[model samples]
Target: MGAVASQDKQATLKGSEPSVAPLMRLVEPGMARVNALILEMAGSHAKMIPDIARHLIDSGGKRLRPMLTLACAEACGYSGENHVKLAAAVEFMHTATLLHDDVVDESELRRGKPSARMLWGNQASVLVGDYLLGQAFQTMVQVGSLDALAVLSKAASVIAEGEVLQLVAAKNLATGEEQYLKVINAKTAALFSAATEVGPIIAQSTADMRRAMAEYGTQLGLAFQLVDDALDYGGSSMTLGKKVGDDFREGKVTLPIVLAARAGTTEDRTFWSRTIEHGEINDGDLERAIDILRKQGAIAATVERARSYGDKAIAALAALPAGAHRDALEEVVLYCISRVS
Candidate 1:
C-alpha cells in the first residue's frame, strides 16, 4: 500500500500517529535534549531499588509523554531547561501507574517483558510504583513551578479516579459512552492532557492558549486510547509488548467490545455475555470475539471514533501559528493513529 493508504488502513488507529520507527525524526534536539535528566532522576538512589525498578526503567518505551511536553513548549515558544524536569516527572508518574496497574490487574507482562509485579512480587511492585510517584512529586518541587505541580497533582488524581471507575464499572455490560469516557479520561487522557498543558503552564501562557493545549491533549489522549482498545482485539501481542486479548480476559469492557456485544447476534451474545463478560473467557474465545467484532462492524466503528479524535487534535492545533514544531505536532496526531509496531 502507499504510505497514505497504509496509514489509512491501520487497525483502530484510524488517524495520524507518528510511526514508532521514525518518531525521532519528528522530534528534534528540542524534544530529545532531556535524556540526561531522566538518567539523573533514576540515579539518586540506584542500589536501593534493585533489578525490578531497573527492569521497568530499562524497557525503552517510546517516551511519548515527555515528547509532548517538549514539542508543546517549543511550539508555544518556551526555551528553558525546566521542561526537562517536567517531562521526567510525567514519565515517572506514567511508569509508576503501569506498575500499580499490573499489580492490580494481576498482569504478568509489560512492554513485552515480565511485569514489575511478576518479576519482583506484588508488594515490591506496588511500593516501587509509589516510590516513582513520590519521586515525580519531588522532581516537581525541584522545578519550582507550583502551577505545574498543581497540574501534575490534578492529573494524578484524575488517573486514580479513572482506575477506580473502571474497577467499579468493569463488567456491567451496560457501560454507556459517558461512563466509558470517564474511565478513559482518567486512565489515559488525564496525563496526555496534563503533559500538553504543562508547556503552557511552564511558559505562563495566556489562558486561551493553555486551554487550546489542554483540548489538543485531551483529544489526542482519547484517540490514543481508542486505538489501544482496538489493538486489544487486532494488534499483535509482540508489537504491544503485552498479551493479546488482555482486556477481554480482564473484562475491561473497552469500546469495541462494548459495541460488539450490543450488536452481536443472539448466539454470539450468549457466549460473550456468559463467558467473556464474566471474565470466564477460555480457548478460542478471543477468536470468537474477533469474528463477532468484524461481523458487527464494531472494530471499524471504533476505529472511526478514534479518527474523530485525531481530527479534533488537528483542529486544536489550528490555533497555533504554523512552524516546524507545530507541523511536527500535527504529524504526531497522524502517527498515533497509524502506528502498528
Candidate 2:
C-alpha cells in the first residue's frame, strides 16, 4: 500500500522531530541487497501461512523492523548478506505479534486497513502468524549463527510473554512501574534489542559492542511503545489506526490511565475502579477520562518518559563510531517521541 493520508493537527511536538535525512541519504547499494533478501524470505506456502501472508504483506505497515535491522547492521560496520536474512527474521517475528495482538484485542483495523482477521478470517490469521514465526526460525537457520539464533529466540519468547502479561494487567488499576516495565520489555523492547544487537553478532563484533547496541535498541523500542500507548488516548482516531481511547474503551490500564488511577481524586479513583478497572465504562466515560488524564498530567508525563528513553538510546549510540547509520538511528529515536500515526 502507498503512504496513508496526512491531515495536519496541532500538537506539543510535531514537525520539530528529528529528520531521517541522514538514513535516507545512506540507503544506497547495501540496503538494496537487504531488500532483495526480504523478498526471498517470503517463501511460497501451498496453503495455510501463504494466504495470511499475502494479506499481511499487502497491509502496508512501515516495514520498520526490517529497516531497523539494516540500519543497525550498517551502523555496527556489518557489510554482509546476514543483515538481509536477519532483518526479515525481525519482521516475521513482529508480524506474528500483530496477528496475535489483533485476535487478542478483537481489533478490526491495522494501518487503517482491515486486519487479517477481518479480511481472511480469524483462524487463518492466527495460523498464518504462527507460520511466520516458523518461517523466521527457518530464516535464522540459513545464517548458521547460533549467537544470532539465540538472541532472536529470546526476543520471541519475551514478545509472547509481554502479550500474555498485557492480557493479565488489563483493567487492573494496581499495575505499577515494575509490572508495566515487564509488559513493555516483553512486548516491545525485546524484539528491538534483538534486531539491532543481531547486526553486531552477524558482523562478528565484540561482545561489549553488541551490549551497547542492544541497549540502544531496547531504549528506542521502549520509547516507541510509550508514544504508542500515549497516542491511544491523545491522538486522532483515524491517525492512530485503532480507535481513539481504545485502551480505556477496552479497559486496558496503560501508564497514562495507571497514573491517573494512582493519583487522581477520590471520586476519580472510584470512577476508575468502577469503570476502567471493572470494564463498565458508560457513554460519557471517555470524556471524563480525558479530564482525569489531563489533571494527572498523564499525557505529558508519558511523553517525557518517552523522551528520556530516547535520550538513553542516543547515549547508547555514543559508544559507536560516528557514521550515517548512527545518525539514522538517532533520528528514529527522536521520531518515536513525536509520531502521531
Tell me the whole-model lDDT of each prediction, alpha carbons only. 0.80, 0.78
**Model 2 clashing residue pairs (backbone):** none
User: For residues 177-235, what per-residue lDDT tens digits would candidate 1 score against the true structure?
Assistant: 77898899889999999999999888888888888998999988998898888888889
| Cα misplacement distance, residue 311 of candidate 2 (Å) | 0.6
What would the TM-score be for candidate 1 when compared with the true structure? Answer: 0.90
Candidate 1, residue 296: lDDT: 86
Q: What local lDDT score does residue 278 receive in model 2, on the 0 to 100 scale?
A: 77
Model 2 over residues 1-341: C-alpha lDDT tens digits? Answer: 00111112112224565555456557546556655655566566556466676567666566666777777777777777878888888888888888989988888888777888888778877887887888899999999999999999999988898998999998899999779978998899999999889988988888888999899889888888888888887887665777787788878878897788778889989999988777887889888888778778998888777777877787788777887677677777656665743
Query: lDDT of candidate 2 vs native?
Result: 0.78
- Candidate 1 yields a Cα-based lDDT of 0.80
Off by over 4 Å in 2: 1-16, 28-36, 45-48
